[model samples]
Target: MEHRDVGILHPGAMGARVAAQAVTTGAAVWWLPQGRSAASRERARAYGLRSAAGIRELAATCEVVLSVCPPAAALDVAGQVAAAGFRGVYVDANAVSPERMAEITGVFEGGAVTVVDGGITGPPPREPGRTRLYLSGDDTAVARVWALFDGTALTPVALAGPVGRASALKLSFAAYNKISYAVAAHACALADGHGVLDDLLELAQLMLPGTPLAELEHLAAAGPRAWRWGPEMSEIAQACRGVGAPSGFAEAAAATFGRWEAHKDDPAVTGQRLIADLVQGSSSST
Candidate 1:
């Protein structure tokens, strides 16, 4: 299989989206049966991306395979790709530390597979071609991924040296993002506890001197509808665990997402609710 004949391996919604985006670059897309998520599977179906019976089929079929599964499942998928003898690139875009990536690479180092480390920053592209994706791997073919993204709307950059640098970048970014979300939610929830969500909003607007309250508000509001975040957040938690960071913080974030899942039908998924629920932990969230 040639690079142009590369196939994409996506196991979840992000993979589906990335696979969908891959079409613009003219790569073949392949995946396991779409999961239970209607919104995600629908997107893949709409794009006419091909579906395989299992991981074995995708590995045997795609030359260059990109996987965006959660960190917990990332290594497992890599092992599967190795078992299926996937030649060419096997990029793991999971939210994991560089150390973990190295371990994952060891599983297939002897095979024909070239492991590419990928890290995705920011949200999925709402409009076509605006997503930022990064790839890092051996000196060879890293540029292939960069060029693939360059050909599309995504701004793909290839980082040189070491297989894990890209994944390290992802973990560092996730740490900051998780912290920001946790802090922002906690602060606003404190305000709400004292009957000051609005007052905090006003004071924040005035005090911060052009803060990102509006954008942050959008993220907070989308919390309830963000069911897909659960698997991703679980990966974030595992990354934190790998590095000895306190898992309590990510545990809070997970609970926040859980509340959103529980009350997706309710329109009142506000900042206070997220903060209070996350602060209270997942079990007592009801």
Candidate 2:
């Protein structure tokens, strides 16, 4: 296999891991450090990703660019890449609505860039078979992206259909996975309010096997990512509306997650505080 030059547009937690996988495959992965936080820089350096001076440099150098950012920023990031004269295979692996994904693809239409829709499901790729990176687009583009991670820690699956298929699949799964966590947090809050918190956990242990309710603290653990998950839930809501499905559940879950936005990346957000935040309908608690 020929060595490929790949660019990672801002290596956050997930992006860093994905780039590291590319590095393991002998791909020279590039990242932009300008304006990125200290933690992002640390991750990029630790993962052995070469730093590009700017988006233009990254665009000018790499044969492929993979985007793994917050859902709301997906379009903006794509637009930046398009503006930077990127003319390669661009993989957007953000959790976003298919409609939003289509808009992102449109940003590069009539250009040299081949836009590959990528939707990541499961945790960050620490090992093989633990995560799936679903790709959909031109068959060649999908295959190209698939080749980047084949036999690596990230399992890339090629999907048949247009660019939006992977996004649809991702949102469809997140709509249930994320919203169910939010709903479980709400239930915990409700029980706490009624002084039955202990009782609910006892009952959940007996009846809610293999569910979020059974592992109550895991829901609180979600707080660190709620800032991004909030927008992801809204994207899922948009997807539901686009399909003529009821969007209420997703909308409500978005609001539920919004209350934890301030806790982004804060490790100290405990289950007790998470339930209290829900009960108060705010994240202002210290």
Candidate 3:
């Protein structure tokens, strides 16, 4: 694959890693820092991404632009890129429902842009073989996007479907993976409320063994990231409802994650403290 110029819109944690991986493919990765926070600027500098004058310039120059932002901001980013006269392939890798994904595609309609639906599963691609970027849309466009990841730490998997199919797959997978974390946190909270936390942990160790115990650690680690997961859980709920599936659990998971808002980005928060807060209905106090 020939080297291509790629633009990464708003390089947050995952986006910064993606930009770095794109750099390994010999692509000149550009990021616009006009309105970004200081931390975002620092991240872009650390990742060695080239600075673009603005979104319009980034969109005008890059062969492909990747939007790896929060689901709520995905449409806005796509609209801005489209308005900037971007004619290249636009890849949206946000954790949104299929409905929202289609809406994003619609935003680029009538523009010279070709939309590629992408869903990223797994953490940042700091290590090879740990992350997969699932792509769907026009076959040729998907192939073009896939080629950009060649020889990079991120693995690209092409899916046989139209736009929104990739987002569906992503939300379906996240529905279970993230909801389980909420379930574990809720279970521990309930047990703690009943003064049976130790008993429940013992029972889980004897019955389910390693995984259940590990979830406790996962719950603790998720505290700082819960703000993001809350929106994702809500997106899962929307995806479920779109298909006439029961969305109660996902809605509850959203609420469960919302409880951790106070601890969002706080490194000092612990699993025990989160559980206790849940049981006491005092998560906001944190």
Model 2 worst lDDT window (10 residues)? 209-218
Best by lDDT: 2
What TM-score does candidate 1 get on C-alpha atoms? 0.80
lDDT of each: 0.67, 0.89, 0.86
lDDT string, candidate 2, 1-286, tens digits = 5889999976798999999998988899999898889999899889899988889999999999999999889999999999999999999999989899889989998999999999999988998898999999999988988988999999999999998999999988888888888888888888888999889888998998667776767777788988999999889889989989999998998888889988999988887787888888779758
TM-scores for the candidates: 0.80, 0.97, 0.94
Task: Give me the candidate number with maximum TM-score.
Answer: 2
> Local error of candidate 2 at 49, Å?
0.2
Question: In model 2, which residue pairs have backbone atoms overlapping below 3 Å?
Answer: none
Candidate 1 vs candidate 3, TM-score winner: 3
Worst 10 residues of 3 by lDDT: 210-219
| CA error at residue 79 for candidate 2, angstroms | 0.8
Off by over 4 Å in 3: 210-215
Order of quality (TM-score): 2, 3, 1
Candidate 2 residue-wise lDDT at 120: 91
Winner by TM-score between candidate 2 and candidate 1: 2
Q: After superposition, how far is residue 107 of candidate 3 from its true place, in Å?
A: 0.6
